[model samples]
Every structure is written in C-alpha cells, then in structure tokens.
Target chain A: MLTRFENRPHALDVIGVSVAFGEVCVIDNVSFHVDVGSTLAIVGRNGSGKTVLLKALIGAVRASGTIRWAPETRIGYVPQKLDIQRDLPLTGRDFLNAKADVARAPATDAQRVAGLVNLSQSIVDQPIGTLSGGQFQRLLLAFALVGTPSVLLFDEPTAGVDEPEEKSVYALIHQLQQNEGLSVLVISHDMTQVQASADHILFLSHHGSYFGKTADMLNSERLQELHGPTVAHLRE
Target chain B: MTYATGPGAFLIPLGMAAAAGLMGSIAVMRRMALASDALSHIALPGIAIALLVHVNPFLGGLIALVLGTVLVWAIEYRSRIPTDVVVGVIFSAALAMGSLLASGDELIEALFGAPNTSDSFNLIGLGAASLVIVFIVRYRSQLVIRLVSPDLARPAGINVPRLDLLYLLAFALTIALGLRYLGVLLMGSLIIIPAATAMRLGTNLRTMQTISVAIAMLATLSGMLLAPVLCLAAGPLVIVIAASIFFLSLAVRRA
Candidate 1:
C-alpha cells in the first residue's frame, strides 16, 4: 500500500553544480531542484558523471556551484555500494548505530530502525559481511533512516539486488516516501525503474543533459541527440 | 646461560603489544597488515643512522616510520598506485640504507634487539599506554565509520583527514614503542598476528578488540616466560608465539 506524504515545505536547490578533475569536467554545470515529498532520479550511462553529481549534492565532492539546503534540512545518504571487508566483524545493528551516541540506548533505536526497514531483529543481529546483497541493501537503507532525516539520497539503489528484490525494495521506498513526506534523490541506470519510481528525471550525458517530468524526459531533443540509439527504449 | 633480562623484558613488550594490538584491529581490517611490515623495515635505516650519531634510536625510528607512513598515505591518496607497492619501495630503500649504514654486530642487534635500560623508561611506556587507551576510547567509532566508507563518514561530519593522521601517528608510535623490544624485522608481527587471530575468533567489533588485546598480551607474556627456558631472544620468541596463536586460531575455527 502506498502511503501519502503529509504537507511539508522542504526544498533542495542546486545551481550550476560543476565538478572538474584536472582537465576533465566530470559534472559540467549541472543544476536541479528537488521539492519535498518527491523523488528525483538522476539517469545516465556509465562515466556520465551521475555519481559525481550525487557526491556533489552532499558536499562530499568540491564543486563550483551553489547547493542550498533548506533551513533545518537533514539528509540521509545510502551509498551505492559499501566495500565491506569479508572478515570485518561489524553487524547490521552496529552499522546502524555507528553515528549514534553510545549513551543513547542505541540497541533499542537500532531495533526500531530495523523494523522500519522490514527486517527482523535476528537479521539485524547478523554480521553485515555475511548478509546477502538484498539484505545488505536493506540494512544500508535502515542505517540511513536511523536519524529520521527529511531527505533521503540513494546511489544506484538496486544495483546488485535481484529483480524481484529490486521491485520490493522500490515498493518499500515508495511507501516510505508517501508516509514520511521524504524527499528522495537517486542515481539509477535502469530507465524503466526511473520512469516508474521517479516523479522527475534528470538525464545526463557527455554532450548535454535534461531535467523535467519523467513523462517528458524521453521527448527532450537534447537527450535524444545525446543518447541517440542507446536510449531509444526510454521513449516507450 | 643466565637470563640477562630487566623490567624492560615485560614492560616494553607488553606496552607495545597493547598498542600494536589496537592498531592491528584497524590495519588488519584495511588489509594494511603488510604496511606495518614495510613501516618497520623503513625504521631500520633510521635505527642504523641513530646508532651512528649516538641519538635515541627509538626517536630516529619513529621519525622515519612516521615519514614512511605519511609518504604512503600521500601517494595512496593522490594517485592510483596500490598501497603495498608504494610501501614496498620504501621498504626496499630502507633495507638498502640500513645495510649500507650498519652490518655485523650492529645489524644483528638492530634486527634482534638489545637490552634497553633507562631510569625514565617506565614513563615512556605509561605514556604510550595512555595514548593508545585514549585513542581507542575516543576514535574507535570514528575509525570504524571511516573504515566502512570515507564518503559516508565525511557527510556525517567526521574529520576524516584528522582521524587518518591521528591513526598514522599512533601506528608510528606503536612501532617505535616496540623498536627496543621486537626490533625492525619482528615488530610488525606484533601488529598483525593478534588481529588475525582475533578475526578468526571474534563475532563483532567489541569482541574483536577484546580478543586482539588478550591474545597479544598472552603471547607476549608466554613468550617472555618461555624465553629463559628455551634460551631464545624474547622479541623473536614473542612473535613466534603470536604466529603460533594465529595458526592455532585458524585450526580452532576449522575445527
């Protein structure tokens, strides 16, 4: 069941976001706005700077532009992939509690978050290194949700999950967005998922880019010329 | 032969073991175990130089190892070169310099350790112990977060660079603390073996830290205890015990 978001005034304004490494301008003058309770999907092929744009949004990467977060805006970021060492003894609960104060009764807080992510207490107790890809992804989501941030950012949200698991994860995300009035910004490679999950699309390519309603993204002449044959299916 | 050992026999190795064990939990997790070996080797030339100049060899070794750590960090941070490769270069250069500076008895002493005695030595040991404790208490969580991903940690407002420099300094100090006891060739074992053993035995971060310290202390104590009986040097013996414990933990896990 999709829950509807409550009315909340929240916004993210990124203006002329540009990132360059030496001679290469990876994210060249990209800009967009995300309204509260909306999902914005950033789409691009590999090496098109989608990830760089995400990093720029969080101030993790230095960029020559303005990223204005609304006053009192809290952001939660779920990395596309965490390089978890196979031998590391960190558990799901520990991962969620990493940023929390130890004196704050993290065990109970972690359990609450685990439940929010639809994970059982036992699964949260298991070593993170031993978790399956889908399970780990859910744990990452739970970890992000620990602080109850108004904005949730995900990078390649379903990169390694199976098809069925991916759908379920997206459904969960949709429910959370509607229920929490959370603003979501995600980078995705799957155009079909982006179309279904995102309210707006930001399509990026080496030559040019477009940002508009999901329904209008494929019709943009700039995207058509830049993406050409590789993205023709997006029109459907 | 009568056992020619002093308070340093226990204090130096035990203090070093504690510091090394803590550092090991981070280093082993990052797969930088061999970097410790490289850093220790990089200290050998410094030790040789210190011997020639009649300066405190521990200070010289600490400076050299810290420089090596900084170089490795800088190179790994700036370029795509693998950490072990950069460390390997430093290790080889230090080895060549060490050989050029000292040989025969001096080389053997530098490699196997000699009796160290100073009226103020206990203060140094106490200081190292306090610093390691404070480090583990204050930054253990931050270190773990950074270990998971710098991208995540940075957004969470962790001072990643400061934390990194702090860890490296602690690592350098740990290696230097062990220099008079374990020597260059054997010191890195103290930093890796316990953590490996703990990884095999532990189920979480807290247990891993506890077990790492326990195993390191046990190995140091047992090796010192057996040193007199076997007529072997304590530094090398402690390392042997630690390795034995690691293999034993492996066997135990398999069982």
Candidate 2:
C-alpha cells in the first residue's frame, strides 16, 4: 500500500555532490537529504560551501553532483539583494500588496508574500528604497515566500536583524513546517537558532564533517574537532 | 519653405527638447550614460556622413552606435579600466573625430542653426524619435531605471547588456537624427541633468524615470524657446538650464 502524506511528497536527495570554483574544491563530494516537514540547518565557518551549496541547489551554480527532488517541489529562494545602488522601484505595498505598479497587477504574489513575512499593515505604502535594514531583510524573506514552495532555502535570513525579529522569523518558519509540512533549509552560524529551528543538521566544513539528526551529530568527534577551537568564542 | 522664417522652425526646439529629456535621464543615472554620451558625440558626422552619401543619417548613426557598443563590450569583457572610464575615453575620441569630419559651413545647418529640418525631413525626424522612445519603453524600459540583480538580467530574464545594446541603438538613431536642432557639442549635458534631478527627488526606478522625463521635457522646451530669442545655441542653452536644475536638486537633497 502506498503511504499517505498530509502534504505532497517532496524530498531533496543529494548524492556525492562536489563543487569547484577555479582552483578550490568547495563542496567536496557531499551528500544529504531533508525529509518533508522537517528542517535542515547547514552550519559551518566562513567560506564553507554552505552558501555555495545553496547556490548550486538553486541552479545558480553549476555542480558535478545530482540533486533529485520530487516533481511537486516548490523552491522559495531568498537571494542577496543588497547592491550599492539598487534600481528596483518596489514599494512596501509592492512587497505587501506584491505589485510593482498599477500597470502590473501583483495580487497573488502579494498574498503569498504577505503570508510568509508577517509584515504589519503600517508600512504597506512606503517606498522600498527607504526601508530600514531589518525591514529590507524581511522584504527578501517575503520575496522567498512568494511562491509558497515545498522547499524554502534562506541564506543568512537574520544576519543583521535583531534578536526578537530573528525569533519570530524562526517561529514562523517552525509554524510553516508544522502546519504545512514544508521542508525548510536554513544556513546560520547561530547555535541557539539551530537548536530552536532544526531537526537535522548538516555540518559543512572544508572536510565533510557530519550529517544526521541534529542531536546525534553534534557530539560526533569530527564535529568536536572542528568546533573545539571556536566553541568558547561562539557563546555570544 | 522660407529659409529662416518658416513653419519648420518649430522643430529646432521640439527636437532639442526630446533629445535633452531622453538623454538627460540616462546621463544622471550613470548606469550607461557614458555609452549614450559617447554615441551621441560620435553621431555628429555619423548622421552627416550618412547624409553625404544621400542615405538616412539615422541609420548611419545607428551603424556607428552599434560599432561603439561592440567596442565597449569587447574592451570591458576582455580588459577593463572599468566600463565607465572606457566609455568616457571612447566618447571623447569619437566626438573629436566626428567633429573634425563634419567641420564645413554646410555642417553648420545640421549642427548650430538647424535650418535643414524643413517638410518631410522634420516629419521623419519627429516620427523616428517618437518611435525610438516607444521602442525603448517597450523593449529597453529597464535601462531607463534600475533592476533587482545583475543575475536577474540573465537570459530568459532582464538582461542588462542586451537591453543596453538595444537602447543604445535607439539612442544613436535619435541623437543622429536629432542633430537637426540640439547640435553635437552640447548634447551630452541634456542627457545627464534632468535625470540627475529626477533621481534626487524620487526613490524608486519608475519614479526616477518619470520625474527625469518630465524634468527633461521642461528643460528642453524652455531652453529651446529661450535660445533663439536670446540668440544662443539651443543645445547649450538647454544643458545650462538642466545643469542649473541639477544643482538646485542637489541643494534640495542636501537640505
């Protein structure tokens, strides 16, 4: 008998994936998966393939490995949008209402974005260029949620954001996974955030360190070796 | 048609206004302003060269513009001092060469006085410019403003390089044909000031585009009307006015 899932079956299976940029081998033959309705926290130091791996999965980066996903997989991508001078003429309502202009109707995009970011109605009509840093990050997050995809990939979603905002964002992510059974993939250096939000963990070091359930993989010796020197300074 | 006093005299200001408003917006944005400026400069005799052969100056200018775009792309894609500096040097050199090629007294009619725009030529110039603006808006509209990401400009997306090339063709055609009124030496200023002013006043790309066009139109019209009455070159007159507006905007932004 075929097993019944509450939501559609969406799984990300990566087998022996290796990536190279010029002379450096970044993601060295890594492999892992995140079951539907669960969270995968990718943790590592600066320059780990965490970001590179995410880019590869998004098809922005060329990869030597295979990433096979279920046919119904919806990818909600949150890419970096902070250039010195951004030419996008988006407004808060454009983000909240999700419309670029009256000439271009954005109702469906707006509703989906509104669902994910949890933006208050206070700033809907505000010009996007004038938004605060935190607001901008949230806007990118909302951008990711626009398609209501099965798999949500976020790169440093809460880097410059404050603690409260970070918690709420994580909480919302948790709620989405619990309610909709969405597969969440988040990259972060924050241990507390990982513990709060992830069920499984992928330690992305230069060397492939650990990949398994979050609790079991943390105590592994390879991980301990990698995390040993930095653990004291990471408390903050 | 009467040589000095005729119905076609209206084109002097109208053409100047269009060129100034359109190019000014591009210049102030600084995205592809240098390229636009370079093409406009090179298009001096670019049109005259075409006119000399009894072909369309607009098409001739377009050929030059295409060549210039290709050159810039080649240099930047291969070796670079950054595209902006490359564009500036190219603009200066091309304009100098074009001016030298187009220096005779008959060239004065195409450049300074614009007595050449009589009957069908006026119609052609006006119609062609309007079409180019429409084309840029429909096809190269993003070049007028900003985009989300450079990658967003990739294939099956809003490709910046392609948009730039297409926009430059239209720009070359307009500037080459627009030579009937605005002249060459003073063309670059018009493309920069109004857009710069608009940028200071607006936050989004769309707002910047709209405000820049509006400002350019105002500057172009007023300058065109004042130049002949004041016995000044229409192109330079418009640039000065646009520059004044730009400073005013900068002062306002600072305040």
Candidate 3:
C-alpha cells in the first residue's frame, strides 16, 4: 500500500522510499520510522545504498519517498567527508556561521556549541585547512550544533579519522543524544558503533532489507542467511 | 599610474580589476577558476560574429557567454558529468570558430585587445564597479555558504540553483566588462591571478577579499604606469605582475 508519512508526529517517518540512477535502482522500496530521543544506525555493504539513503533522508538528492519530519524538527548533518579546498582562507568560526548571521548570531552561541562538542575557543579561530583529522571531525560536529537541530544525521562520521577516534566520536554523539533528546541517525560500517550506540537498526541490500529494534534485527534468521556467519558475531 | 593616454584609459582597467578581483575570489573558492577561464575563451566566437554583423561585440559576447553559462550549469547540475570536460568542449569549438572567422590584425586585436580606441569608454565600467561594491558588502557570506556546500545552503533556505545562476550571470557580466581592455583570451587571467595571490596571504575570507582587491588595484595601476616604458599592453603586463605577486606570496607563506 502507498503510505504518506508527511506531517506526522514521529521524529522521522519514512515510507516507500526508493532511489534510482538511470536504469539501476540503488535503493529499492524501504520504509522505517524513528521516535524522538532515539538513535538509529543504517548498515549496508559498499554500493548497498547506505550513503544514498542518508542523502535522500536529508533531501540532498531527490528520491521517490514519503519522508516526514515532526513539525519544527530542525535537522543538522555531518557528511562522511567534505573536500574543502586546501587554499581557501576559511576559519572554523567562519564554517560554523556559514548559515547564520554573523552579526546577529551571538558569540556565546559558538562557544556554547563548541563546549558541547569539546572544541576549544582558540581552535575555532584557526584556519580549517590547518586542522588535524580528529580536530576536523570535532569541528564538523560543532557545525551541526549551530542551529540547535532536534535531529542529527551523520554519514560515516569516522571514515578517515584514526580508528581509535571512532569510539570517542560516537561517545560524543551518544552524549548529545541523551542530553538534548536529539534523534540521531548514523550510517556506519563499524559494527562496534552499531552495537554501541544504535537503539534500532536498518540493514539494507539492493533488493531486500531488515529494519527493527537493534536487538531483534541483529538476531534475525534472514540477516544470518544473508550475511552468513558474520551476523551471529555482530549480535551483542 | 602615469598614463600616456587620456584619464578614461585608466578607468576601464581599474573598474575591470575591481570586478575581477572580487568575482575571481568566488571562482577560486568554488574551485571553478579553470571553468571561468574556459568560459572566457568561449566568448571569442561571439565577438567574431558581432564584428561580422556590425553589431556591438559586447552584446554578442554577452549572449554567447550567457548561453555557455546556461549550458555549463545544465550539464553540471543535470547529471554526474564533470564540469571541466563539458566547458572544455565548448571552449575548443568557440576557439576554432573564432579562428575561422577572424585573421591578421583582427585576430591580434581580438585576442590582446585594442582598448586605446575611443569606443572603450562605456557605462560598463561604472556598472562593474557598483557590482563589485554591492557584492562584497551584501552577498559575500551567502555566496561563500553556497560555494561551501549546497547541502548546507539548502537547509538555510537558500535557493541553491537560483543563486548559482545569479553568480554565473555575474561572472559573465564581469568578464564582459573587461573584453575591451583584456580581450577574450586574457580577461580570465585578471580574474584568477589577484584572488589566487590573496588566498596565499590571507587567514580568513574577509582578509582574502581585501587583499585580492588591493593586489588587483596595485597590479592594474602599476601595469598601466609601466606599459608605456615597457612598450607592452596594460592587460598582459598586469597579468605578469599579478603572477609575480602570487609567487611572492607563496614565498611569504613558506616563510
């Protein structure tokens, strides 16, 4: 049945979402919903449409889907990577205020957001081109914090950062989730992250998928059949 | 700058430099400097067509560039094709058509410009100056946001496609303003060099923009002054000087 998820009360309610590039269908019919103050992790292999799904959710790319956000539920996003030109003279403070009025946006707003992401005030004045990988990730997190978004979406947030930094970043995100009641949707290949932070899981393949509570989704017989023995080890 | 010609000669390049310096910074930040360069060359055939039909060359170049800009915009946003390749194809065709249509002194004048002629004085100089001032004063931040990432700009309620079209139109207009002085081939150099030099020297967007305009003004003024002594055209001399400034900034950056 065709479903309309618009103007609903859920933090994010997606129904019959599908994306196609030319003749190839990247993401087939998929549907799911997340409540406020919860974390959802989307898991898929390379080319299984994980990134596309996240982009579609944020309306970055067009897709045939019914995506509804609860009224006034502002969104913030941290991309998997941003290829900022090395020569641009953009400072971290400039990045944070890219979408805000520098004059009207209080200075303390940046400080407060920076505090949430554990970023120092001094670092915000430094050029973004000079930042270390981990520092850059923290700045990206601060970027999402600027507008006080109720829903935050992160796409492979630690893809290029050091592996150890992954846990720390997710921990920061988890902290934000609890403290602000922010609905979190993250796409990650790290099973540890999936096990650690996700309240629900959406596992997608090109033609088929699974979506449910994290515990139930991990123990599914179909998931085991699809991913072989790896699924069993992922269960926590 | 001591000009052997009338004071009006200095006005055109001065205005052109201001527009190029500011707009070039946007092009550089968006990583579209090469695309801007290619688009300048695509104006050649239109100038030739205008010369053939006895119409204003600026009108012809503007029409061609607007069409080219639209084509580049369509190809870039419509599909996954890389922008440089699409613009490159159009540029090459325009260059060939221009070569076929013009020759001898006409070709030399079209490529290097003949700004000493009386017709060089136009309201475009005033229009370009106003555009530079207004753009810097108001739209700089929004333009920066759009260039940074359309994804971010969209959530901010910025109409990404419309803003992109507006920027491209402004780029075309800026380039057109310089066609009498810098010509089709060399106008893009004025647009790219000053901004690139300023980028090496700055730590923030405002500083970069300020430095870009300053460098552009210095280069244009100095080049105009030296043109008579060097027996060279002001446009090309300005480019050489701007390049020297860029390398000097690189040295400063390394230091």
lDDT (Cα, tens digit) per residue for candidate 1, span A164-209: 9998888888888888889999888777777787877888888766
User: CA lDDT of B73 in candidate 1?
Assistant: 76
Interface Cα RMSD in Å, per prediction: 2.4, 6.0, 2.6
Which model is ahead, 2 or 3, in terms of lDDT?
Answer: 3
**Chain A of model 3, TM-score against the native?**
0.91
Binned by DockQ into CAPRI classes (incorrect, acceptable, medium, high), candidate 1 is medium
- After superposition, the stretches of candidate 1 with alpha carbons farther than 4 Å from their true spots are A1-10, A102-107, A218-222, A225-235, B1-9
Q: Which whole-number lDDT from 0 to 100 does residue A194 have in model 2? A: 85
- lDDT of candidates 1 onward, in order: 0.80, 0.63, 0.80
Q: Give lDDT: candidate 1, residue A121.
A: 77
| Tens digit of per-residue lDDT, candidate 2, span A12-89 | 888888899778899898888877877888888898888888877866667997888777676766554465344434
Q: What's the true lDDT of residue A93 in model 2?
A: 54
Query: What does candidate 2's lDDT look like per residue over B1-255, in tens digits?
Result: 113344466554465455556555555554655555555666555656776787765566657766876777677656745667777878787767666666576466445535334445566667766776676456533442234443322211244566655655666566655555555555555666676677677765467667777777777677666766887766666678888888887766421
Quality of candidate 2 docking, DockQ: 0.22
Off by over 4 Å in 3: A1-8, A102-108, A228-230, B1-9
Give the alpha carbon lDDT tens digit for every residue of A1-236 in model 3: 41222233579888999999889899888899987877889998789998888888877778997988898887888888777776678888877766455224565667778889888878888888788788888898887777688999888989789877877898899888889989889998888778878888998886597898787777788888887655666774
Candidate 3 per-residue lDDT over residues B1-255, each given as its tens digit = 223377866776787788889998888888888988888987888888888898877777778888888888788788757778888888899899988987787777678766665564377667766776676557776787777777766655567787787788788888877787778888888889898887888888888888888898889889878888988887788778988999888778421
State model 2's lDDT.
Answer: 0.63
Task: Give me the displacement of residue A70 in model 3, in angstroms.
Answer: 2.6
**Model 3 residue A15 lDDT score:** 93
lDDT of 3 at A22: 88
